[model samples]
Target: MARDYNFWVYIVTNEHESVLYVGMTNDLARRISEHRAGEIPGFTADYRCTKLIYYEHCTDVQDAIAREKQLKKWSRSKKVALIASLNPRWKDLAPEILGE
Candidate 1:
């Protein structure tokens, strides 16, 4: 028997709900924590896109990366719709990741 790993494609937004960033990670919780802590430098850090509003899991890393690319190309409205479909309130899902 073997353990399987999951890859995640996620959308993170800023406080004002104006900016949306698409990303992929193997450890979603740790990655989100890095965003929150401002440890992962670059656009996400500069723009403060720390809210974990949307995510989809895939067993394949290539699938996750493809989904991330697809999301990055979508219009902001379409991205918002996608997030709202899963997280209507646009809640910070990082807390849920910690079982809070």
Candidate 2:
């Protein structure tokens, strides 16, 4: 039997919630951890985007990537509205994902 895999389109923000980032990954938990640990370097690290605010699951990688691209193209206020729709308080969803 073939195993199942899930792809994700996610949003994360800095502690101040001033910087928002959009990304796609196969492993949400690991990816968020990388952002938090600053292990990947670059924008997430530079912006200190450690809070996993919103995420959507997709069964197809193409769909996830497309969603990520769409979100990336959205205006900042639009993105903020999207995030608020799912995460009103902009809570850190990392610990939940990490199973803490």
Candidate 3:
């Protein structure tokens, strides 16, 4: 049987907003929590990019993955513009996803 699932393309930044990380995940809230907790020992953890500044929803997993790859290839200024357009202040949006 085929099941419809939700995928999310999300961006997280460090405390100084000097770095950005783009990723796709099936569970946005859980992923963000992992980032916040520094559970991953890679880029997000190394750079402390735990603030969820932006996200988008896609019903198709392929689309979400493609979007994440595309964003990763984007220039920093372009990525910052994209985030600023939706989140001008670059605020941490984890609470919304966390249902807090």
Candidate 4:
């Protein structure tokens, strides 16, 4: 049997650490790849925010969307706090996501 793929709400940050990008995706790897490759043109691509700083998984898409929306509305400090909770060093979580 195939394993179920969970949806995720994730945040990407730039090198200067001032900007943040919040988004949701079923395949975290593919989405991150798109961001890194600059395949999707927008704030993230323009700002070069390809570092996956934080993420939260959900079994339901609606929950993921709600969480993404909530995060998007948060202040930069609040977002940083959330990211720091799981990633104190604010490390790139992409490798973790890939189980590497």
TM-score of each: 0.94, 0.94, 0.94, 0.90
**What's the distance in Å from true for residue 100, model 3?**
1.6
lDDT, model 1: 0.91
For each candidate in turn, give its C-alpha RMSD to the true structure in angstroms.
1.2, 1.3, 1.3, 2.3
Question: How much does candidate 1 score in TM-score?
Answer: 0.94
lDDT of 1 at 61: 82
What digit string (tens of lDDT, one per residue) describes model 4 on residues 1-100? 8666699899998888889999999999999888888898989888998899998889888889999999999999999899888899999988877676
Best by lDDT: 3
Better model by TM-score, 1 or 4?
A: 1
Give the winner by lDDT: 2 or 3: 3
For residues 8-79, write the lDDT of model 1, one tens digit per residue: 999998999888999999999999999999999999999999999999999988889889999999999999
Candidate 4 — worst ten consecutive residues by lDDT sum? 91-100
Ranking by lDDT: 3, 2, 1, 4
* Each model's lDDT: 0.91, 0.92, 0.93, 0.89
What does candidate 2's lDDT look like per residue over 1-100, in tens digits? 9777799999999989888899999999999989989998899999999999999999888888899999999999999998889889888889999999
